[model samples]
Target: MKFTTLLFPAVVLGAACPYGTYAPEEPTDTRGVCPMLNTLANHGYLPRNGRNINENQTVQALYDALNLTPDFGRFLFKAGRLSNPMPNATTFSLDDLNRHDLFEHDGSLSRQDAYFGQWSRFNQTVWNWTTQYYTSDLLDVQIVANSRAQRHTRSNLTNPMYSLSEVGYLFSVAENAAILSILGDKVTQTCPKKFADYLFTNEQLPFAVGWKKSALPITIQDLVTTFLAIQSATSFPPPPPDDSSVDIFN
Candidate 1:
């Protein structure tokens, strides 16, 4: 199925948490990670109400929630950098990381960590596939350019002091660029022409209205809207028809 077909439903379904279930008293705290996680959960990117706002998120938990372990492992192998292995021989989970204190269950996930993880996952899935399948170099260029365009300092993000808008802006920029690069010549055909045009012009995405304004903290709603916009613009090739003997994951 198309990437949008496969992933958009997840984003939509993420909005179905039981009423008043995981609503934190303060959902806009820049220093807290709960709002971000809650946003992801509510939008179907993660399990709804799976975690509390103040609970520390382990690297393993994040990877597991995102379903990135196996694919990331495959990417590492293809890059000729697969060294360590997780307990399960068939997959690489974050529990294998060598940092003892960092890998602990209660280890606080830094904003820097979240950004790097997102970068790695986006590189492995979108960038690598686009480069290989379409023989394109646009994604590589965008990745390099975006790395320099980042406005937030590592200290600020790592200290977990970022507002919701900051993270949303960062995500929108990187993700929009990735979508544009991957679609390439087919962008106009695949996505809404206006959305594609906006991305091509490097204009600020309309979805980032309020959050893009200041250092103001963000709410789950802001994240949801941003994600929905990104999802709406992305399209991927359809998967092959299923057959009992065929392995779809491969």
Candidate 2:
């Protein structure tokens, strides 16, 4: 799963805003476990209130802000919708996405396991472990892969209740893929560690750091290929499913 070397002259880069401007403000309303989604809300790509967000709103926001293809955005939103407890609901608030084993899962890059509770907020201790691997300004796929595998290892040893289903594992891999796709340089195949930190710690896009939306759209195939690259760099047992009967995601 090697990516071909791509060389494109760096385009003049600045803050890429789908909304009027990239002014990130504290959300006066609820936020989700996803740092990217929360960042989108903070930047006014989605409703600042983070409430009653429907599929169309989410899909459009992803497209406008990150240049994610509409179909890929819809795929992500479909997984997110599963977290909502409401049956037959097409809309979900950011808070609704906190449901464990659905969209949010254990061994997050910056978040703690659900067993510890308060899992939505940033955890510095967990983050510190990951930061050690950010040895350079640019985080390549292998570096990102190592960081993710290390986090999973730490959680496996520390969190007694830590569990990740097959689906959860796939989502976990895709998350890192999304980060790289959204914030990394397409020609270089790496993301800025500074930009990654800003997104995780502040839950805001690093517009101040001169990041712009990728000139090309991020497709589902792009994400899937990155997922395979990450998966190859790490190994963990297929975790048993958590004992919860709610299987709405199927």
Candidate 3:
């Protein structure tokens, strides 16, 4: 699918604490992503050990710049990658799991019979806010008043001004993305061509797999911890019926 050229350096850029604290311990070395991204990874929104992006782009330049990254490796990997349970192929969502909705019929929304309706928006929020807060650092970074931040070191409270509901939503959104990817990978064969490339370039899953081959127990644990840490941080949509309003988010 040729994603390198279509890729953005979102993984490398840093995000600002619009409502919370913005004191990062150190700069994330990803050439493309920023500091916020680093926090997300460290906190588990993304796979712990992933790509190191640098720089960013917008407008047509964004497209042009994304096109410059390599996509072939990712595509090749996805086309043949197998699900852990022995599916013939990998799922497109390496991080998400409850993606059964990708093909299910929904009553409220069906812009058409042939199409499944709109693409998922969870990723959009992550991407949008990722771009949004980073470009325009605001002080409204909302970490819920009673959230874990309250228990964390004052210095470690990335942003402590948020109400609990606010932080819960953010935490929910991030956690959903990561878990859904993992779960989604479990159910499918032939990882989505587009996502495989994205993961290969952004999450550095390939590096983790290679580490496993060396048979170093510590490295294997490192790989798991990294992936787990990232997976543990972010979030994706809930399992269907996705009516989380009544179900409550974890």
Candidate 4:
């Protein structure tokens, strides 16, 4: 993917607290983090799935599933208020891990957090090639928008954060578009033709491609399916070059 070096404004971004603090009044038997972890495992993103669906997700488990480093967690704590630890802390305690439902199955995921993870992952890939991804600066901007201004913007475009449904839609629209833009046509053409066509046709209307409306809560299944689809489309190897032609000079 092509990397763009954009100037990031030096601004301190505040973090927002999780959705809610109170324990849920009603909990369902099937509601928990296991399904999400299972989906990731099935997709080869995780090693195995032994977690119970009814149990809350731990900080370490989340980081592991997302393939994020401890430094990234510290960055999130410092920038997004997603987590809080003692000053200069490297790991999360049990209290810090269980402090919010955002880390649990019962709590819904926010569009901001979802965008943060997606962008971070993409930026990491870019960083592997070049040191100009501007991930930290962009994350600071997102934190400011998500927490201080109550808005979520990416690539300088304003987007909403109603729920996980919105997150899915944004991922389908903005995130995919950003990837396509960064990778350019040459790289994107390597993906399955049908998948590329689907993305092109549904670029504007996410619901047409199975993304639910913004009001509905996106299930773990939906999130996993979306990620799997993206992985299948974007992570495939390119076709080998034709070697049938003989060299005239040789």
Model 2, range 142-231, lDDT digits (tens) per residue? 888888888888888989998989888888888898777667765456899998998788887788787788999888888877777777
Clashing pairs in 4: 15-80
Per-residue lDDT tens digits for candidate 4, residues 1-250, read 3232222221211112121111211222112122222232332222222222111233243354343344433433332233334565443322232332334211111222333343211122322222122123222222211221222222124323323344334333333332222111212211122322232322221223342212322233333343444444332234678777867578
For 1-250, candidate 3 gives per-residue lDDT tens digits of 5675445354334343221122322343221112223333333333334242212211111122122122322422232132122454332223221222222111101011112234221233324322332222211112111121222222123323312344333333332222222212322211232332233234322223321111111212222333343335433334566564784545
The per-model lDDT (C-alpha) reads 0.31, 0.81, 0.26, 0.28
The lDDT, on a scale of 0 to 1, for candidate 1 is 0.31
Best by TM-score: 2
What does candidate 1's lDDT look like per residue over 23-86, in tens digits?
3223432112222333334333333333222112322233433322443323322211121232
Q: Please estimate how well model 4 matches the true structure, expressed as its whole-model Cα lDDT.
A: 0.28
TM-score of 1: 0.22
Q: What range of 10 consecutive residues in model 1 has the weakest lDDT sum?
A: 102-111
User: Residue 13 error for model 1, in Å?
Assistant: 14
The true-versus-predicted C-alpha distance at residue 234 of model 2, in Å, is: 1.6
TM-score for each model:
0.22, 0.83, 0.19, 0.20
**Candidate 3 least-lDDT 10 residues:** 105-114
Candidate 1: lDDT of 205? 33
Instruction: Using lDDT as the measure, name the better of candidate 2 and candidate 4.
Output: 2
